[model samples]
Target: MTSTTVRPDLDLTHARWQSGTQGMGDVEIAFIEGYIAMRNGGTPEVPAVIFTPGEWNAFVLGARDGRFDLT
Candidate 1:
């Protein structure tokens, strides 16, 4: 599993969370301030995963290349 350490000093309340579906499911993914947050179905809470600009770039590239595919 990919792990990230959330900064306690970051105030996410004002953060603009852009939500979208990850392929097909009730699960939701949110992006804000270089952080990606996921909320599963039937859940009310979501933890934000912090990522650096470089890491985010790599993730995007990998995702585009289907490196995260699960079949």
Candidate 2:
């Protein structure tokens, strides 16, 4: 993967999100594959997390199941 900075807080609704190395670059999304991608809009050169669709679903499910309880 390419070394990059993070830019979280980016406006996704307005971002022209794209994939690969041929995009606006200003967008805040990068399609990693059929099930995952990178997202970072708080800094411009920090690496971001990549999550598969299934993994994301599991996380949401876990949160709902109290697996992420914080008290």
Candidate 3:
């Protein structure tokens, strides 16, 4: 079975990052080594925030549920 666990030494040097559909210079995300890596397109030199699949799912659900809505 495919593992969803990210390796401690995960390498993202060759990650093919994809930007949001809105346009360029937005947040970029890369799925690599069983982890999700996110970084700002405007500042790629900065370290990315890594998330596990479960964490990503939770964040997505929260967004869809408007848990982060300002209202």
Which candidate comes out best when scored by TM-score?
Answer: 3
lDDT of 2 by residue, 1-71 (tens): 89654434433333344554665444355444443445555464665555566776787699789998889
TM-score of 1: 0.57
| Alpha-carbon RMSD to native, per candidate | 4.8, 11.8, 5.2
Candidate 3 lDDT tens digits, 23-43: 955689999988888899888
Q: How many backbone clashes does candidate 3 have?
A: 0
Candidate 2 weakest ten by summed lDDT: 7-16
lDDT of 1 by residue, 1-71 (tens): 99765554455565555445355655554566556554553453555555656677888799899999997
Once fitted onto the true fold, the runs of candidate 3 whose alpha carbons sit more than 4 angstroms away are: 1-7
| lDDT over C-alpha atoms for residue 35 of model 1 | 60
Clashes of 2: 13
Choose 2 or 3, whichever is better by TM-score.
Answer: 3
| Candidate 2 runs further than 4 Å off | 1-46
Alpha-carbon deviation at 3 in model 1, angstroms: 14
What's the TM for model 3?
0.76
